[model samples]
Target: MFIIELTYKVPATEIDAAMAGHVAFLEKYYHSGHFLASGRKEPRDGGLIFARATSKGEIEKIISQDPFSINGLASYRIIEFKATKKIKAFDDFAGDEI
Candidate 1:
């Protein structure tokens, strides 16, 4: 599992301008089963993405394609972790090792 944290470098107006393209990018990944969930941060500073990948390289490659990254609107921090425990509904994502 990977948690992608995006910290916006530009103002809200700039972020809003690219919102449509950003959403399109997210939808594409969601359809491909790469992204599980995503949303804006509490203070609206940026956003977060819950993604599933076999390796950090895979996630990085995908992140490079995000509109925010392309437009230099945000900086990203990728955190990878193993899910040792999760709800039964998430069993498929947690993997048998959990």
Candidate 2:
């Protein structure tokens, strides 16, 4: 799994301006089964996304499509992790096979 964190690089106005496109980008990935979950941070300074990809390069390619990235409105911190365990309710995410 990957945790893609997005921190604002430009002003809030710029981020706001791209919110709709960003959301659409996210929805596209979600429908494709690449994203598991995503939302804004608690402090609203940025956002976090849980995603499944074959490799970091795949994740990078995916990130490149984000509106925030295309408009240079945000910076990304991509974290790759092994999904070794999860709640029974989330058994699909409990292995490294993803």
Best by TM-score: 1
Alpha carbon lDDT of residue 72, candidate 2?
86
> In lDDT terms, which candidate is top?
1
Query: Candidate 1 residues 1-98, lDDT tens each?
Result: 88999999999999999999999999998988787899999999999999887788888999999999999999999999877768876766545331
Q: Which residue pairs come into collision in candidate 2? A: none
| lDDT: worst 10-residue window of model 2 | 89-98
Candidate 2, which segments miss by more than 4 Å at Cα?
93-98
List the global CA lDDT of all models. 0.89, 0.86
Model 2, 1-98: lDDT tens digits are 88999998877888888899999999998888788899999787899999888899999999999989998888999998865656775656534444
RMSD of 1: 2.4
Question: Could you tell me which 10 consecutive residues in candidate 1 have the lowest summed lDDT?
Answer: 89-98
